[model samples]
Target: MQNQSFLAMEDPLDALCHHFSLTKALLPPNARIPPTFDMTLSAPPSRQPTHLFAILPPEDNARVPTLMIPVSAGLYGQSFAADLLPAGTALPVPHIQNGNGAQPPCVTLPVVPVSAPHSLSIPLVLLFGLGLETDRNLLAQRMLPAQVIGEFPHFPAMVGVMAKLPEQQFEWYLGYTHGMWKNVLALAPKDAGLVEFVQMAHKVIVEAGRLRGRR
Candidate 1:
């Protein structure tokens, strides 16, 4: 009997790819892989140190830490600023320091800023909520990409596209993983290694689609 169950589902990207046997054909050539880049999003490359800075706690004795997420230099910067940042500002979060010798009850760190080619526009910053004094070790490892994806809509959707490929299509699989890494890095300040990844992955996606079209 034909497998009619999967056809009934709303999202057929994964299932449909599996139903067909074209997964292996879509894999990129091993020699075509870039030497400086790694497909897994496990860690930032040697030169491209990951940018994860602690954002000040919102409330007194709060138990969370918010971090900065930057964007790339492009025309879309304004769109990002207008869509995300709070009103009347270039930088979304303001500096927080107590007048007295003691620490302020709440701290607000500046949102990650980008020097794009775009014109002056409203401020754009996104503040993530993290409780105070959390363990750095625990947070880094325990936090799933899904959790981070939940917080930000932009990269998640792009990553969603890559997730549709079958397991045998290692090329596309790597592309998907690396694409997500590039997407995350694009949001942060310019890192040379990451910049390389973004350019390469963008080309990979475009080329992959072309290959699929010709087949």
Candidate 2:
């Protein structure tokens, strides 16, 4: 059934491939598999050193510990890190002083302004939440990537996808586990392929919910 779905939606599958390539090119050189952290479609964990690359809502700035690196709008009418930062540019790392006056542990993270030619040497948690709305722009302005919407329409969607694939494959191929698939579901236009994908994902989410209840 999964094979048939993949075969039937050849165009969307191809679009997925293209999206993956385009998104990967924007990742920092030192970007590695981020540590396991709890996340959801509406809310991300507040305390963890998680890296997010989504168009976040304004409130997220306070909820999540993130350093904003504003960039020029991309040709696709979206803002991306690669467009703003030059290749091989050194990103600024801020040091936080513990209130106890104790020397904080030296933490290494990937630098910002992730350019194409340069590679970040330090391991940083890179959260790829593209299309998340940080500004008060209209709904159309915050449309997320099709891949994100298709695979992770909601938190349950992550659970659904995870149930089907091994951890390694999911992490290596998709980068992040949690997503706002519901957001995408709301914004997506009426297209046969997209609707079919959403339906399949929705079923997976429902089944996952059922299994969770059983547990």
Winner by TM-score: 2
- Residue 35 of model 2 has an lDDT of 26
Instruction: Tell me the tens digit of each residue's lDDT in model 2 across 94-206.
Output: 22222233532222223333221101100011112232211211111122233334555475655554446544554332322113234223333233343354344445545
**Candidate 1 — which residues are off by over 4 angstroms?**
1-105, 109-190
lDDT of 1 by residue, 97-201 (tens): 333445322223333222222111001111111111122222222122333334333544434443444445635434443434443443442334433433444
Using alpha carbons, what is the TM-score of model 1?
Answer: 0.23
For each candidate in the order shown, give its overall lDDT on alpha carbons: 0.29, 0.29
- Model 2 Cα shift for residue 153 (angstroms): 19
User: What is the total number of backbone clashes in candidate 2?
Assistant: 11
Q: What is the TM-score of each candidate against the true structure?
A: 0.23, 0.26
- Candidate 2 positional error at 97, Å: 40
